[model samples]
Each structure stands twice: as C-alpha cells, then as structure tokens.
Target: RQHNLRIKVARIFNTYGPRMHPNDGRVVSNFVVQALKGEAITLYGEGNQTRSFCYVDDLVEAFLRFMATGDEVTGPINLGNPGEFTIRELAEKVVALTGSKSKIEFRPLPQDDPRQRQPNIAKAREILGWEPTIALDYGLKKTIAYFDGLLRAGDGDLARLAAQ
Candidate 1:
C-alpha cells in the first residue's frame, strides 16, 4: 500500500452484473451459477448479511469522474449502490431470475463476516455527481440472460467450472 502519488476515489463494496464466475466465492456469482446448474444455493451464516451492489458501468463512470476531478478532490469515496440487500434476498432473486427450481441452503457462517454492510455514497454524489443508475432487478435479469445463453450453448461446463 504505497501512499505516494495522487490517488483519488476509493471505491468500496462494488458488485456487478455479468461476467461473474459461475462458482466463484462471491455471493452473487455463486448464487447465480448454482441456480443455473440446478444446484442448491448455499449461503454462509444466517443469510442476513447485507451488501451493496454497484453496476459495472457505474463503477467505470465513477473512476472516470474521479480521474477528472480537480486535484482538490482527494478521496476514498465509496462508489457503490447505497441500496442494501440481505444474503437470502439476493439468493431468492437469483433463483427467480434463472427460473431455476434450486433450493436455498445454508452452511456455517464464516468467521468475521459482517452481518450488515452498505456503503455510504454521499461523498460520491456530492463530489463527483456520480450515482448507480442500474436497478438490482434489471441487472439481475441481464446477468441471468447471460447465464442462460451460456447454458444453452453447451458452454455451461466451462462457465460452471470457471465460476467455481
């Protein structure tokens, strides 16, 4: 963690739509991939943990704005959707989007897992005039479509493995 040159915005709690691995450890990716593959969705802990999801495009835009900001703007701005969601809620959304009959399952909660997390994006809005425009439902739908196409194309195997 070198603190030398100018570093502008610091984006925290970034989640996105597509290109997420099918079996990656990330909750969104794991849930989507599991539903697509007809596997049970596993949530660590009580599934009450909350997180902020930011669309990929919005993240890029935030970075652009940060870079463009005058030198006066030196920040560790949280570039993420202020909207929060519980783990279970997200899993349910994934199932609905994929149209998968997968079941939700839970395992032991990981140690040090925060039960609640949502970014405070006030700085981003006030400083960069940036905000996440994509709604969660819309983003999930797009991500599901991508997963569906992969499954239909017989690329499910690759996608599933990569996701894992």
Candidate 2:
C-alpha cells in the first residue's frame, strides 16, 4: 500500500507442454524424453509422491484472465491443475504414450523431496474466474509429439544432450 501499485502474484505449480527442452530436468520432461528414447523412466523413492500438472495453454489463459481483472483483484493466487497423480503413474503414462519399452528405474528420493504437491485454486476461481481446462492425458500427448519431432529432427542429438 506504500506506493499503491497494482501487482499480481501467482504461485504456479508444475506446468508442461510443447517447447519444453528434452533435458529440462523437470519430472514431466524427464520422463517423456527418457521414454521416447527407450531409456529407463527414473522414479525416485517408491514413486508414490503425487503432483498436480497444469498444461501451458491453460496457464497462459489464466494469466490473461488475471491481467484483465481490476486493480482490486491483486492476488497471491495458486494456479495449477488440482488433479494429482503419483510419480509412477506419470512414468507409466509416458511409456504408454510413447510406445516405448523403457523400464521403470527406482532411485533414492532426494532428502528434501515433498511427498505431495497440489494447489488449492479456490481463490483463483473466486478472484480471476480461472481453472485449468486441459487434462493431463491430452497435454502429455501433445508434449510427447513435440519431443518426438525434435528427436527425429536432430537424429537423436537431443537425446545425447539429455544423456550428458
């Protein structure tokens, strides 16, 4: 209130879609790229930890809606899909989508890894009238196609970069 400037703060959760780098290290990209290349899908811990994934298109739409709101609508709002999935479920989905024979490789969970991550978007709905419209399956299929094209274009060059 010091300067009375309008500001919007969005606590964005996991988002994935086309144009994500194959080696971005984010879980979605990691699993998708690995499966596409026939590499083991890495799952840390018992893979029971859950996360909510938001598609990029949905996120962008939320941004636009939030921006169109009046100054009184300043928000520290959460933006993401409320649907949650276990890490193993994500890996299995990636494998199925890519039609890859990759195995699931369990690794030790990082010490600080959170067991669950799901956003409460009630404020987003009340304030900005926003919620994600894309389902995980549809988004993942689009992402997989993008990565597949990249892999083919580079003749597995991107895969090498991921391996490095």
Model 2, 98-125: lDDT tens digits are 9999999999999999999999999999
The CA lDDT of each predicted structure is: 0.82, 0.91
- The collision pairs in model 2 are none
TM accuracy, model 2: 0.93
Off by over 4 Å in 1: 1-4, 159-164
Looking at model 1, residue 89 earns an lDDT score of: 92
Q: Which candidate number would show the highest TM-score if scored against the true structure?
A: 2
Candidates in order: C-alpha RMSD to true structure: 2.8, 2.7
Residue by residue across 1-164, what tens digits does model 1's lDDT show? 29667767585685776776665577777787789889999988879889888877788888898899987788888888999999899999999888899999889998899888788989999999998999998988887877676677775694554454
Positional deviation of 152 in candidate 1, in angstroms? Answer: 2.6
